[model samples]
Target: MNWYLKVLKQYADFKGRARRKEYWMFTLFNIIFSGIAISLDNATGLAQMGVGPIYGLYALALLIPELAVAVRRLHDVGKKGIMLLVVLIPVIGSLWLLFLLVKDSDPNENAYGANPKLIPV
Candidate 1:
């Protein structure tokens, strides 16, 4: 939950590294919210489809932060943030980003900064 708040706080940040917790936590909340919107839309029948639009707008607004986090997360892995775009190749792209997200962070700091995951709370 704290991680979700962290990303929102950082919002447009694209220069620093991001820990896996931060990325995944934000992802989780996004999914949950989208789910609720969809559920609401379904529960109220087509007349309530407006719920989907609301959440769909929410998602569209989040695109920058999502991309920012993706780039930063790749930085944590010591990879170029641009590597994120490689995922555009369908399954390969998704798999690549998934690999970076789950892959271990660099053992030492790279250009982005000290490993965020290693920062003492």
Candidate 2:
């Protein structure tokens, strides 16, 4: 939860490196929150999603953080952050970026910052 909020706090900040725990924890929280919002509507038997607007805002709020983290993560690999653009290449591009995203961050540091994975969560 702290990781998720920390990412939000650093929203659009592309300069620093983010560790895998921060990135994946934020992703996990985002998915979980969105699921909870949807589940509320389902449980209530309401025709409309009761928390639709809230969840929508949650998504809007996190977009910049997501982009910044991805770019910085690429930087951690000594790769140009713009390489993230390769993710746009349909099936091939998306898979390629997914590979980069899943790979471990460099053991120590690169040009970005300290290894995010090494930080004590």
The lDDT leader among the candidates is: 1
Candidate 1 stretches with Cα past 4 Å from truth are 44-51
Alpha-carbon deviation at 81 in model 1, angstroms: 1.4
TM-score of 2: 0.77
TM-score of each: 0.85, 0.77
lDDT of candidate 2 at residue 36, scale 0 to 100:
81
Q: List lDDT for all candidates, in order.
A: 0.82, 0.76
Per-residue lDDT tens digits for candidate 1, residues 4-116, read 77787778999988888888888999788788877766676732535666566777888888888878899999998889778889998899779889987887989989988
lDDT of 2: 0.76
Q: Per-residue lDDT for 39-118 in model 2, tens only?
A: 76567664263655555666687778888877876776667789889977889999988787777778877777787667
